[model samples]
Target: MAYKYSIGHLTYTFNDLKTLLARATPFRSGDALAGVAATTYQEHVAAQIALADVHLDVFLREALVPYEQDEVTRLIIDSHDAAAFKPIGHFTVGQFRDWLLSDACDTAVLKSLANGITPEMAAAVSKLMRNQELIAAAKKCEVLTSFRNTIGLSGRLSTRLQPNHPTDDPAGISASIIDGILYGSGDAVIGINPAGDSPANTRRLLEMIDNFRRQFAIPTQSCVLCHVTTTLDLIEKHAPVDLTFQSIAGTQSANASFGISLSLLEEAYQATLSLNRGTIGNNVMYFETGQGSALSANAHYGIDQQTCETRAYAVARKFNPLLVNSVVGFIGPEYLYNGKQIIRAALEDHFCAKLLGLPMGMDVCYTNHAEADQDDMDTLITLLGVSGCTFIMGVPGADDVMLNYQSTSFHDALYLRRTLGLRPAPEFEAWLVQQGIMDRQGNQLPDAGTYTRLLGGIGQ
Candidate 1:
């Protein structure tokens, strides 16, 4: 169906829901590159205005990517809860945005509405929201998940100690891990992205981290960001696997590009469950997504990148993941052109994922080529911290040697925690205080001897 709205003397017509959504999206380079972006600023605003009057139920009836062609679309349509959607069934997109910002949408109400809200609905409303509105609405919805430690707790911010090494050297990776732990990071998980995907090398990396975790009796999890099939092989070999990791995308074809299927993911989830590695809780999946993945893989099927990115959350939520993050700026300038675009995409991803009931985190990062810097990252991290993000990356000095990008440093996590009065996960916080790395008041203790002891204890 064609949707039309007038701006001054011009009448803008969107031929379909997908076109409407693409045109209404805030200016990002990926859509422009894909030839789906609005051609002019007036057309963009007109599309937004036309979209606001679209009834919430219109999304339920229309699948942006046809239900027959995509499994992701099928999953979304099949899993929707009509009964839960009944309360706000009558609201238009604009009214839904208003309802999200109103006092009526508390945490409990948001939780009840999770099953009812489709990814498209979440994406649609997000396009109409400002940055602060996205933050405010997301702050009210709490998504808690756990493996060895609880994440997404109120007043708690967690960090993924990403100790990635270019050569997959155990010594260098171990040093980064030690650095992160002393800074009160790694409560989310000490995940490594190995240089190679060899199963033997993956096993070595996993065993190395697991041994260190056990030696210190750390209350956290360990993951080597390898393929799901390799991790599944390691699980069969009884390697110490705490969480199954995968880089997922929104469309079936896009995930196929990553060599993963819904059934394969389910199989991995079940295989990891058989080990029973978690102590606190059993949410055992970790997923990473980015905006331009589908378009990059040539599988977006004409939908905008942001909406396709939001659909990936449906895939994540189905697994009850411990950590699900959007590596927002990692896709570079093509998807998110600059610091402003990166920041907007990060906030939108967090809000849409949280609303869909996933424990959302952000890899507030950018490639060297992107028009962004640590200053932009600082702004993004502080905003996410205030929005109650589940976690952020804690790389060494805001740089990933293996991934070749600028991410949040361990000190950046500390800055967010200290500035916003947020603490680490409860279990990991206790361990930090017990080790004398931090004080009872959540301040890092300035003790050189304590640091010396931690460094000395690394190998033993």
Candidate 2:
């Protein structure tokens, strides 16, 4: 017999972690102040470097411990994972400042590589050419993505959550997401993994998005920011949801049926934000440029920039909601070919194209990781919150949670917040855990009573 059909979709993400840590130039006392007088710039640069060092020391330590065990570590892990691992990457103000002063990059090698020589340096050039080829080959080799900003997450993006495992019931999975948000688990975001099922399972998607706020039991006011079903139900079933829900059409499903390209996307977006006084609902679209990037980059079916730019303007006029970016490799081979281009078009040109122009407020997306002991965790904590994106949503591998009939990802959730700058207040944190929306160590799954009480807390 054919499969009994129920869930919306199954999102398949190819783990491509070979990007390697963004090499930083280690701090050279004189490097930052080289242009300025040593006397004048010394103290300023020194102070900044010192502060970063302190943070690094603390950050490194925190990266090693688990959330419940460490106070500060939870914040870092939570920032990157509270919700999802956004592909956009987290770059904090402090991180940026440090990125400048850290001198983490190896300048000598960079300088040697930049300056070309001949004859006498012919041997060097040959070796360099071989090295370049090696680098290219390394990038081409698909690897596990480490969590953003983690010990070595930059190029090696390993996810804190387990990516390989059994899936959960659609609504049930969504319920866990809402639990994270309402009780304030990670980043107050909802992740809907229709994989390719939502459009087919329209009703499920509709109910999930409509009941998004209710699942968390957070007051409507507190329910301002969230992510949910990509079903057009915001326009079709219920009133268009506020900035809370970030709707993304499934990869395989967003095609001829719904015209998954940017143009159709923006058209639907504008329609949702029209605000039809009695006839229409509020116009709020969570703006994310990269969501479609991989689609366009994929040689097989990615949308063109021209079309993407048009959709960007249309949504800007109507104010688009969230943008759940795409990973570069999943769609095709070219690094910038699939997902990267789509993101640039939506976020870069789309913003510059129209008469009114699209606004920033973006969302980055990525996948799981493995190695990245400490540095990567530290990095993700600083990078996930940058760019125009506000909330990050990603898959919570079954491995991230306790083994049970139902699957979840406490690690994924925790990693998300830490990668960014989000830190949940301890009181609320304790309250959420006691509720059991978060998995506790047990061989069994969450009971009906636990689910019921958890959902109850969301609305109350």
Candidate 3:
């Protein structure tokens, strides 16, 4: 019998799937309950549901029972027919894992379950899945999104410039930026964090980046990641604001620590959007987030740090930022204690944000006090690249003088491109070729005296 029906535009039926599963040997493992092999669609559905519940119970009791928190438990669970447990958020990370593993859940159910949980809960549950599984989910979630109109992401890999200087000195910072561009990095954006947070210092830095771009005829944008109010002030004074930068937190109270209210964020977004300053188009915002910011501000509300971090994305989405990255390891040893934690958090953060339809990148980096090294970063960068990461931070020698940390360097970007056969953003790649930094084939021009020529007359 043909078991197909149309509900609105979608044309698939539960009975058809049940019948198919009944006949499919792949679904009839010895582990499946007796008589579940499809005498009827209703019986098959019941067996599958029961088996899924068993998986949830075992997983919750074993894997996630210990780390269970009350706040998480209080969060909603997106189940049809009201999960036996009220407020699915109360379900442990293990339970989320169980639901994800059940394979019985349709796309709508998956999204509903994801909606009821916090970003951190999503992140923690992600830690239970294998890398390939997470990557597959990310691939299918390729949303038709655009930011900067320069850096193409979602199905593509990209990189960025963190041309930071210790004293916020424009000349010294310019040198680092030139080096980055000459090496064919910074397609995402030439975003810098001012060592000094004052509005005056921030303006000078912004102007300097803008000047370099104009002088070299570089087709890209710049950002001075000072406080939002300070950037807003710069915008009022008519400073060069290509992308407004802010450090957003998950909770309102945590955001208050940064002096960022939702209203203030809206003000900044509206202000920057009106400027039309971005090189590609005027979708101008850059935000950086980390797992520990809420706790650092003493505003975690007893939620796990990762969930708190993910909630920050909701704030970012409001502005439609050209770039939004989780500086995953920058917060140090307290929240994410080591390399293992950092890697897992990095993957989880990227996965969750992308799932939420944000152009997510990862600051695959670590502080000196954190128990991580170059090897761990290499692993993360590769894994994230494979998972279709939008971008990663490209610094000098893998170190940020201003931020006082290690990160992926310009050469690292090249290595990813070469190893994975990836390319920089189209416009930026053309600029690199025109500058002779990279050949037409996207290969770096022979390093013979290229650096000397690129840096010539800079100090003078």
**Best candidate, lDDT-wise?**
1
Candidate that would win on TM-score: 1
lDDT of 3 at 52: 27
Evaluate residue 417 in candidate 1 and report its C-alpha lDDT on the 0 to 100 scale.
Answer: 91
Look at candidate 3 and tell me the lDDT of residue 455. 63
Kindly list the per-residue Cα lDDT of model 3 for residues 217-249, writing each as its tens digit.
777777888898998999999998888888888
Give lDDT per model, in order.
Answer: 0.93, 0.30, 0.67
Q: Say which prediction, candidate 1 or candidate 3, comes out ahead on TM-score.
A: 1
The weakest ten consecutive residues by lDDT in model 1 span 451-460
Residues 357-449, candidate 1: write the lDDT tens digits: 999999999998999988899899989999999999999999999999999999999899989999999999999998889997788887777
> Model 3: how far is 290 from its true place, Å?
0.9
TM-score each candidate. 0.98, 0.38, 0.74
Q: What is the lDDT of residue 183 in candidate 3?
A: 75
* Tens digits of lDDT, candidate 2, 1-460: 0111112363222111000000011121212222211233333333323322222123223232244643222323332221221211243224422232234523232222211111111111111122222222222222111111111112222111112213435545555554444334332233343333444343444354446444444322112222233435444565433333333322223223233444455555555555432112243444333323323433212222222222323332333332223221122222223233323322332122211222222222222321212233223223333321222333343222312211224444355444543333233334445655443221124456766665554343
Question: Which stretches in model 3 have alpha-carbon errors above 4 Å?
Answer: 1-128, 143-148, 447-460
Q: Model 2's lDDT to the true fold?
A: 0.30
Model 2 misplaced regions, further than 4 Å: 1-168, 182-189, 198-200, 215-234, 237-263, 274-283, 287-318, 322-381, 386-389, 397-452, 455-460
